[model samples]
Target: MSLRQRPLQASNSTSRTTSEPPGQPTNPTQPNCHPSTPPRKGIRLNRILGRIVPIILLIYIAFAYDLVVVRYAHRHLYLQRRRTLLPIVWLLPAHGLFLWSLRAYLRVFFAHSPQYTNKSSGLISWLRTNFGAAFPDPDEAQQLEQQRLNTLATSLSNTEVKIELCQADGQPLRCWRDNCRARLKAFRMRHCGDCGTCRVGFDHHCAWFDNDVTAPATLRAFVAFLASIPPLYVIAFGPLFPSAWHTLKQIKDFTASDAVIRSKWYNKWYSWIGGPAFRWIVGYALRASRWPKPSKDRWPHESPRTPVLVALGAVFVFVATALAASSLTQLRRAMLTVDLERAKAYGKLRLQMEKLEKLTNGSDVEKLTAIRQKMETLSPTQYFKVSTKDKNSGEEKESIVALSPEEGLLSRGSAWANIGRFLGLKQASSSDGPAWLLSEPALRKILQAAALLPRENSN
Candidate 1:
């Protein structure tokens, strides 16, 4: 037995699902121990910044709203036209997108994601009890979930209910988290140190949102908020687009000074950074400072709030766009940010082993052995212990087996389907069970790979 594992309680259930090699030894835990990330608010960087980021974002958003809508778009210059309603029409979509993003942001802030308890039943009950089709309003559903789950856990604690957890190969799927050992876990289900809760479809603990973004609930909103930024900015800056474009064009040419401004855009201070990108950024500041009213005197009498806000907004939009693209691309590949990172490490480990195998002669057996051990450690195959009762003796027996990594991944279907399923964009029927898990056929393939499907007569 591993040092991390504890002896499980005996159950009244006598069902034996399988009688063969489950998959791998069924006791090995996930590599990420709680202490490494710490299962509580342990003065981590994300924990500290999470509180500050949303406040910063809200302030920025307020500033941006004041500058763009209140100051610019809502001005007489844009809406002073004869057909004022037509000119103000563009603000509709901008406001919609802004509100949508805001809604999503608040959803993240409130931890409106579908969270599962650290129990086997959480796998199924989350769909029913969490913020989904049944409970559509996230504001009400979010906080009550924990209380509801606590009540459920208390009610079910002493019952004779079996905590069934089977991986792809019909082996026990063991979670080593202190809170989640008895819970049914979907693939990619992980414990968030900051939240101190196990999340299925765990994406990343976003410091900006100050919350964990679990899939099938909050992932949809998180990505939607990010993706809507560019369009929101575009619509928000309808009439001001020309001036904004001109400023950006000016910013592009580091030495290109505005004819109206007295001082040249070129300055020795711009070259202080000694990088082209840095120099161009300095140029934007200089150009914005020089931006004047449509008059002979192009120098600004006061602070250039419009140009500065525009520049700042551009930075936010750029970051949001890149993040959105990166997130979607990973989801399209049927992977979370965590899975992608793990896959990279696995790939590197595999490559090192291959190189070592080819380079080393028979004399360097120890080095090769060490590499082989690392490969197995990195392998997707993992174990969990299962207790089964013998029919004849009526005695319980414990054994271990491994499950395939593919079972957890669910990367076998069409790419679009995979993305839709992971995002919970697909409508599910009651019979479908959970989209977070693999289908029966998918499980059969994994089981056959290990030749460990249970016998029909074993019941």
Candidate 2:
């Protein structure tokens, strides 16, 4: 039998009904018709808190130690040494370099676009539809779904065509022979409208950067985090190196003499310059500065004169910056390579050539050849003349529903929200509504796909 003669099989048996199409609207008299709710601000806040609280606590502790403990010790020492003009030469540039590096980090993070969210969503929707399961199983169900998709594809390709005449610019034009011809043309493809998810790369939806953390923006943010290391290390260690060294050695506690405290403060002078030039000067000063004496030194002349701690800190900063720059460059190169590969692959599938081949049936091959010649005369971009309206009714309709603010902010779109909004939250404030009330796990799974959080790191 011809492929077109085969009966169309239902994509799913349980979820669909014989009376209505999949995802079709139901009668108002139907019981258990619950509408979904809009996502609550409280749920969003909880998710944000879950991810942020631990990091915030760590930062708070670190800040408290620096402000309360470190600063207090310095004050008690009454370090009243004259500001040395020699160190200022090195400090200014070092400070500038650190700031410049930080700015570069922020720039990279913000430059990343959220284009990948749509792609990921499309992939997910394709899997869900083709598999014929809300969640795929490894057994017989998965195999059945795959078979159905293959059958559907083959049937679509083999369907017989009939010619019809249409008036265009007062001239007769040939068009397709199908019942839903207008809808098929409107969507550009027949099956796409029936598919559950939006087509990836074909359609772009607004994406929340936080939802797709692996998106360019998130990756850029990660890169920025990495780039921040050198400057942060330098700022933390440059002036504080001597004090750190003293603390580590159990030599004079931060409760030291005024001269020693002033010396420690002056040692970090390179931090003021804030750039590479400042770094060079700071390195030089650290190598030249005298080391502080130990309280229990049996022999005064035996103490080391070199500022070893300061020299080491400068070396660490330079090495860190070099590594971060190299890594960022490599990552950018890899992403560009992948994009080029995808473009090359897409270019090979010429839809116009496929259309021409479809027209060449029986002995009318020469007629089809002439049509192909005419098609080739047009520019590649102009080859596919997509009409804005259905030829019969001349009414233009959107293929995909545009997302609204509430629906656009989360999930694939408003489909999930219908259920959430239907369930009114009388017990809690709108802001405190729990995510669990709106299928928390499924929402989280979608958000995770969007990359709002770090991916599971196996290593």
Candidate 3:
């Protein structure tokens, strides 16, 4: 059972004893043992900043331009009437296009459902017909996970792959339950606790998207969606002031007279809903009541909307630029955020193992065992079958090969090859079926690295 399914027991069920192993702290709250939840307040604030702030900025840009700039400028500013139409000319098409894109993106994001391994499941069948299905029910996901784990276990000997296991605190080497990795010729679908499903090429579960973004089937769409948004922001905000200025003249002429405005029959309803806010703000502004006293009007003696809109646009550009840069980097690397992080973790784990080897006596069995235990905790180890044919008999025999993160260089490949994999290309051979594979060059390098590992193990 996963940690989520594990039932909570009485506090006294696991008793603490003073006679614990030396050099090993008995505290379960150690940094490496259990990760802590971030402060709730900070998390809430970040969510507001990331999601709500952009919305607020967008709303502010609209109101600041219309209410403050256009409305007031027509009455006071000395700019030509044609120049006053700039903001309207610029914002209309750009904003309209962005809204349309956002609508389409939302449709894709929330509507797209993932395909699970179990084709027999009713949910999967339904999803095949209706790609808009958001996600599988929790019970269904749990069932699918059980089936996946069962299948993975049956393919491996003893439901686990055994390797040399050791820990820094003098733990002996042994075959560990949690250390077993996938040895089958299947997609390495990682079970995400947060997403509550096994996602192929699993990436980070983005709270912004509120979905499990993977790199297999959905990667191209995901990247394309990401690549589209930043440009929209650029178009909208990059020429924020210029658009406002270009359309200034038209806005000035339209508002030059106090002529009563009437909306088209189709847009009457929309105007009815939105017109009240405009009326209220205008009435309040003209009354000199200054409901929001010491407002932008009190300072600068010039068009306050100019600076305010510029500031809003600048903030938007900064955020969009960062996201664009990050998405581009991920695209170029051809790895999901989670996959990249896992690769980095592998490098760190290998470094730690090397350091341990350098510090310990080469001939000490106990020390070596301790090192193996540490290795087991860092990542899973799997036993794969490598077939060889005897030349004389023309008979094939299979030998089991144990591989771990350090020795198994499957996901990390040349950028181009990784990109091919990300784009849903399969490199299946008739003999191997659909096994996870590394580039030939990467495989050769990994074999060379694996060859050196035994020397350290012997030492």
User: Top lDDT: which candidate number?
Assistant: 1
How do the candidates rank by TM-score, highest first? 1, 3, 2
| RMSD in Å for model 2 | 22.6
**TM-score for every candidate vs. truth?**
0.64, 0.26, 0.45
For candidate 2, lDDT tens digit of each residue in 395-445?
Answer: 432111111113221222243232222122233214423211212322233
Candidate 1 per-residue C-alpha lDDT over 1-459 given as tens digits, one digit per residue, 9 for 90 to 100: 011222222222322345553234543452322232223434688888998988888888887777666555554435443345654676777778888877767666655333333343654455334432221223233233333333333433332112223432344344554445444443445666666555656777888888777766677778888988788777775556556566555444523545532255354554646688776566656666555454432312112454556666778789999988898888776777766665677688778767877777445778767655555434454443344344455544443434555554356366676567656764531333344444444444433333234423535
Candidate 2 local Cα displacement, residue 37, angstroms:
3.7
lDDT at residue 8 of model 3 (Cα atoms):
17
Scored against the true structure, residue 121 in model 1 reaches a CA lDDT of 63
Global lDDT of each candidate: 0.54, 0.32, 0.42
Residue runs of model 1 more than 4 Å from their true location after superposition:
1-56, 77-83, 112-186, 193-197, 247-270, 286-322, 356-377, 382-401, 405-409, 443-459
Where does model 2 exceed 4 Å of error? 1-34, 40-90, 97-222, 235-239, 251-459
lDDT of 1: 0.54
Q: Please tell me which model should have the higher TM-score, number 2 or number 3.
A: 3
Largest TM-score belongs to which candidate?
1
Q: Identify the superior model by TM-score, candidate 1 or candidate 3.
A: 1
Candidates ranked by lDDT: 1, 3, 2
